[model samples]
Target: MKNTVCLIAAASFLCSCGGITERPIGVIYTNAADPIAATASGGSRTGTAEATSYLGLVAVGDSSIEAAKKNGGITSVSSVDTHRKNILGVVTTYTTTVKGN
Candidate 1:
């Protein structure tokens, strides 16, 4: 019974992110930058914002389009993209990128 409990906990911890289906999440590491939006015209400027999580307990940072635009000094948003990196389900970082003039 103890062994079964441990296995369940391990499985839950391994798949804690629940984003494995969205993208192939590697148990050891996951680093991907994917485009979430399509654009008609390319942007002249770009900005990025980031958010991070520690052991799915403490999460910090602002990964928002508005924040990205603010940081990049972009007025109009032409396209939006996201970059995600996770390590052993312990540390996770999410970044939002905005492109515009």
Candidate 2:
């Protein structure tokens, strides 16, 4: 019984995988010389967008900058970040976040 339980645990561990992944898509350097430019020094604001898909086939939607902008309520951004949460590589949640003034 002990050996059987150990084998099952090993199999389950090998078969299951889940975690969070983050990626940077772009970055902007804010300069004091340009008022219109996105500056790194300012009130920090964040916008997040989410996308959902099934089996990597049929997809409902995807995260976009426009969505992020709407969420964050900002005109420009200094940097963009992405995150993915997956369950058994079947269902995935894609997220996009932006930071700026």
Pick out the ten consecutive residues of candidate 1 with the lowest summed lDDT.
16-25
Model 2, position 96: C-alpha lDDT score:
78
Candidate 2: worst-modelled 10 consecutive residues by lDDT? 25-34
lDDT of 2 by residue, 39-75 (tens): 5665478887878877768667658867887789867
Model 2: how far residue 31 lies from native, Å: 33
What is the clash count for each candidate, in the order shown?
0, 1
lDDT of 1 at 9: 83
Highest lDDT: give the candidate number. 1
TM-score of each: 0.77, 0.55
List, residue by residue over 1-101, the lDDT tens digit for candidate 1. Answer: 99999998888767745654776667788898899886797789989999999998999999999999999999878999999899986999999999988
lDDT of each: 0.88, 0.61
Instruction: Write down the lDDT that model 2 would get.
Output: 0.61
Q: What TM-score, to 2 decimals, does candidate 2 have?
A: 0.55
Local error of candidate 2 at residue 93 (angstroms): 1.0
Clashing residue pairs in candidate 1 are none
